[model samples]
Target: MSTMAPACGAQQPGNIPTPFDWWPFVAAPIIGGALVYVWTNGIPIINGIVGASGAALGFSTLTGGAAGAASIATLVLYYVLKADGCIRSVPKGANICFSGIVNDTTDENSTAVDILAPFAMGPAGVFDVVVKSTYWHYVTDDSFWVYCDDAGAAMLPCLVKSETACGGHIGSLVGVTVGAIGGVILGYLAAAAVGIAIGCTATGFFYLLCLIIAFIIAAIVAAVVAYAGAVIGGAAGEGIAAAANANDPVVKAWKGLSPGDIVTVQGNWVTDDSLGNNEIFYTTSINRTGNVGSPGPYTTAQADDAIPSDDCNSNSNPPPPR
Candidate 1:
């Protein structure tokens, strides 16, 4: 019996074509969520996307929906907690600007690649206490930390600050030259006195002539030694200065920073999960607004004054939410 020739691609008795795959629908959202995770942690987007895509493809129809739902739930929970003041989640690329007194600084590392300085917003003890204890901390959270980076160094006051580190060490060169000349003169005199006897001169006129010659020779020697020393010292000084300037602008700026200086930091705000969702300013610019020795641990009013009117807290003042 001819079995109806399988009706041209119709489903066979036992083999029903699997329903159109629903996994792709589920995987798309999951992949997107993973990308967000990668981006927040500073992973390259293309790499994160490719890796996430690969991971998503492995999901089967049964597991795909569950994974996608979990991703959605995780994202929703993050935001909800963020709004409820239970979690801190600052989106990447939020414009951030604030001013404060520098409190402590962490040296650059391979991961950060920039100097991180934590500054004080309000009075150190009071503000720090409030931030640690309060639920609504984000409003005041930004005032404490800054990243001194190469990009920020190219900006206004930072360039001005680093410029001071670029000049040659003229004082060191001069000191070395003077020291060399004095040493040569002392050594020449000591050797000449040891070899020459006072009685060797037959007449006073002869002795005077010899003395004149010795003085001339010593002067010439000192001049030669001083010139050679000057050249060497000058070169060393310039080399040192050049090496100092060769470092990235951020390093130069970091050298210039001090605890008492009032600084205004500007950059994109990112919440560092690695630092426990602590917000950081990935600096584009750092300005030494003023140099007031130990201006903070300020009162709330004084801290408000430290911030520029155009910045993050322009509308609100800090000290636990209203």
Candidate 2:
């Protein structure tokens, strides 16, 4: 991932991917889901970060922090790195973007790496992390509760509005809807079992109760199935996409990461925001063209022979002129 930093130096090359990565793509969601269970009781480690953002709509409780950021980052990185064949070269005096939630970022010239990433400055903490992508995936870990995706995070609000909210609200509703359906079924089954023991079907009023029970069971089953189909169906659709791309080249597109273009210091960066007072910026425009010290996934070449590449020298900062 080409960070918005300059003085780009080198480290190790990234690993080439193999077909084996397909497994992680399939297990990503399953494994992540399981962690929620394990850490359900307020992840003691970084629970504070969740409330950092406070609630979004009163419906919001610590957004991207429901599941532990470290947990999600670890799970995601383990799979994504394998899937993407990304490498973590040594901290080349440039390139600083750490994934996962960064909480209490206080380091001085220290290097903090994304646990998923072998490289990406580290030792800092995440206040919270928002995965900006095709889906609204996040974990709120501050004051409210740690949650993931729309289900863990989006479900609560839905449940408040309707017990049967599906589509985006399915995650929250599944528990209530499924539980009620199961309870009704079991209640009917139990009633029938008791009836069989004493032959209550022919007992007039008792027989009428059995008929009502049976009807209620049937109706609930149909409604639960309909709602569930909507929820699981969305997941199945994502599975189709994962299966399709499992063998394709890893899409090395990290957010806002690319090569070739020189980004003027639109932002500030440091080894660790706490590590040193020396924040690194484009004091000079360094040329990455033909500069083998660049990071990947490489974008298409931008300049041709006419353009002169700036050296990673201090003088190059502010590139003397054209």
What C-alpha root-mean-square deviation, in Å, does candidate 2 show against the real structure?
21.9
**TM-score, candidate number 1:** 0.28
TM-scores of the candidates in the order shown: 0.28, 0.20
The residue-by-residue lDDT of candidate 1 on 179-238, one tens digit each, is 443534343443244226443364666765665454444434444444444444444544
The per-residue C-alpha lDDT of model 1 at residue 250 equals 48
* Best by the lDDT measure: 1
Model 2 weakest 10-residue run by lDDT: 155-164
- lDDT score, candidate 1: 0.35
What are the lDDT figures for the candidates, one per model?
0.35, 0.27
